[model samples]
Target: MQSNIKPVAYYLPQYHPIPENDYWWGKGFTEWTNVTKAKPLFKGHYQPRYPADLGYYDLRVPEVREEQATMAKENGVYGFCYYHYWFGDGKQLLEKPFNEVVESGKPDFPFMLCWANQTWKGVWFGDFQNQVLAKQEYPGIDDYTNHFSSLLPAFKDNRYIKIDGKPVFQVYQPLDLPDSKVFARVFNDLAKDNGFPGIYLLACNVPIYWEPEPNGFHGVISYLFHSFRFREKNTVFKEGSFLGKVEWKWNNFLEGKAIERRKKPKVYKYEKVVTKISKWPKMNFDYYPMVVPDWDNSPRAGNSSMILHGSTPDKWKIHFHNAVNYINNTSPADKFIFIKSWNEWAEGNYLEPDQRWGTAYLKAMKSCL
Candidate 1:
């Protein structure tokens, strides 16, 4: 019998309720001045009253929360892998919905953290478009250490599943803070100090290519290859050592230059991250890769630096099936298939049903698994 482990959805709980205005910004305090000042691109996009000003950021609304839970629970979704954003300081935003999910006494499925350590500015919380709070300053190790210390209780909870007995920690921007070596040491040591054996640190290797160190730290290495090129046909990868040496050939960007002023590299280059990862023999690893509907964050970045617009729910299923096939064929039955998100509005790659095709994406996810 096929293992009961249905595919897992990585939910990046933006928790931005549907905004009244057609504009993308959710309701909250927005710093239009700073946003417009950041770059010329924000001229028309950055408005004084953004989506945040409309109260869409409030996930506490009954209708909003119900929609989220119901949508996630719909169509045989195994569970949600919440992208837990930590400020690495005392202040943490958006913990409310997650807290409610856990403490609401509702039947919540398994969830884990992706530790979005990227700098958060008003653009997100409507604080400042151009300027973000510089939290990860020099001696960044100390900042994250303190943040982890605060999150110890949540880290140890049973809901927080582990890979090979070590708690899984996903880093949105691994290179933002200290160098890779320091990050590796701090993560392992801190995790062990917190009574856990070690941490399975997963990083986003989208723009930055990652190769496991010859003597790399123990953890899971994941690559967020969200593009149509990777999805195209005849992309054959000779299965082998991706560490420091893996190659690929494809057109990374689907859209043209004038549309978004984002230049698409003629030769879309990338290491078959998973292919390389599969070659590792001694290390314990899990593929926490992502499936994207499309890559159009034009709502945020006016000029589409990276665009992939032709991805439909049906098209996305190919990646879904690819992940499932990979896991079933390669890893054991219990392996987790990490998705981009259940709801990432800015980027068009959300599983949540939208006005364009209500429930089409979620249904695709359901029927596939």
Candidate 2:
């Protein structure tokens, strides 16, 4: 294992069927429904990327989790940061896989939870608003405590990823989190009470300029997807300032008028987005750099998808190399480099072996490690 450089990949837990999805989508529906139906919109676009070794296994199967952990560990991935969904209070979606991992203790792989605190919409079936499936609601102090209480089992698990004896808890939409400081304080207090030093709170989907500590977060992991990476089309520069040293982050997406209002998929070369985005103006001490293996959400968004024209294993090697170096130079506490995902088949951004490239992407990352 690389002690100084930890590569943690985001793991999506939407593979197995859930009652919520069955009702919202269709009977016996999972992410595979979207993946198998994706059709190429352009000539060279890769569509219907099929899994090689893992097949379309259900997450409810313990053997599948074991195999995923084995693959991840063999390729130098330090841990799997599962996308944990908490609609508020003790309500959650996609909790089965990780819950089993915690209770069964079979894989024995390191992991952490990232609260996907967002409402479930009908976007899956193409209806954005009218069909409200699961709306996020933050009740009050009691609910917050119960939320922490529910996670106590996973937090106490020996396999839970931690820093300085503190379990790392991530919030996917920290910007949407009401009273982040309070949330941090409450979670930290709860952790201390549970024999932990404190909870290492990390925030995601925030601007590059966003500071973590001030906002009660230990650090930030900006999901620099090629689609939303603040650059040329929306970037602004100070008069006579250095070229790469100027412009904004995704705050424009959050603050300014919406940009994803396109009728067609927005496509860009992977080389361009990775090359330009990796040229950091300056190393951010409070920020952990992220690398994306590939991206194409057409499987989910149809024509409105944001697609990266070409992303091969060869390109991933260079991108991964840059991110490893970037993380290596950061403070030891911030030495973690995040991969966009281990498996998000619907989004076309996953490191898991696919028929298109097999384990080539993982092999490329192995070279870096």
Candidate 3:
């Protein structure tokens, strides 16, 4: 392992599933079913396959993980950061692969969890897309303490990565988190209580929207802007009737207004957004961001949602190279580089080997990592 070089880590959620429509998207919603009782959220798409199938299909299946491990070893890549989701109230989501790695033998790579404590509503399996049934709200410092008390043991695992002699832990939606200070304090207290000395609590602030104000807790925050949709549209949805298209002339008027609004520049201001977040003394980098190939959740659109059209592998490669160059030239060598995901099929931003592109994205990652 290249200890001196900052590792390139992936956010690998073990429960990321290929939806067979096991949840709310099917006949479960039709009026014909008066006798039907309970149903899965994505009832139209996929079934709940074994958790092992998730890792097998997405990562370990078809020899992808083996291939990745071989490639990482060849490339001097340090580790893969599995997004460990521990339901603090005694529920473990997708602990199989990690357990297997530990039981069989030590893994070739080091790993750790981001403490995806935000909530559990089953989006992990592609069943619940934007249909968040519940949220594990910030349960205050006490809950975090209880949560970390268990998590500390996992941190002690030899596979966990450490920064400055401290284990690295990530939080997926820190912005959604109600209190940032209390969160930081809880993490610190937990680390001290565990006698781990220090903890690197990295917040996965993808868009840099909830940029923190410059404070001592800046070290706890890490800027990793995840670009799910970087594709530009010829038209903007400027002031359309909120109730999807109405009468013909009314729709034309809405279309004309939208066209007229096009005079404004569509270029995203990354520097400004990063600047806003960086002002808080947070660990801001010129993010070599990842872009989703596409994001058309219309499969779940029986409930009515906009379709994300137009995403090609070639265009995705452009974003991938941009990320690589940004990391190679822009980001600090000593700082960690992150990818949006190894698997996030629902939103369409995935690095996993998919049927559409095969290992094209993985090849792209090789050039980058």
- TM-score of every candidate relative to the true structure: 0.66, 0.91, 0.59
| Cα lDDT, model 2, residue 250 | 41
In order of TM-score, best first, we have 2, 1, 3
Structural RMSD, model 3? 10.9
155-274 per-residue lDDT for model 3 (tens digits): 777767776667877776565566767777777777877777767666554333333333113333334232212211322332134322223234333432333333222222333333
Model 2 clash pairs are none
Residue 221, candidate 1: Cα error in Å is 5.3
lDDT of 2 by residue, 128-235 (tens): 443568988888677778999999999999889898999999998876777888888889999999999999988887655567787788877754553254354665
Local accuracy of candidate 1 as per-residue lDDT tens digits, 143-212: 7677677666656777666766677666665545457677777778888887888877666543323444
Q: How many backbone clashes does candidate 2 have?
A: 0
lDDT of each: 0.51, 0.80, 0.46
Q: Pick by lDDT: which candidate is best?
A: 2
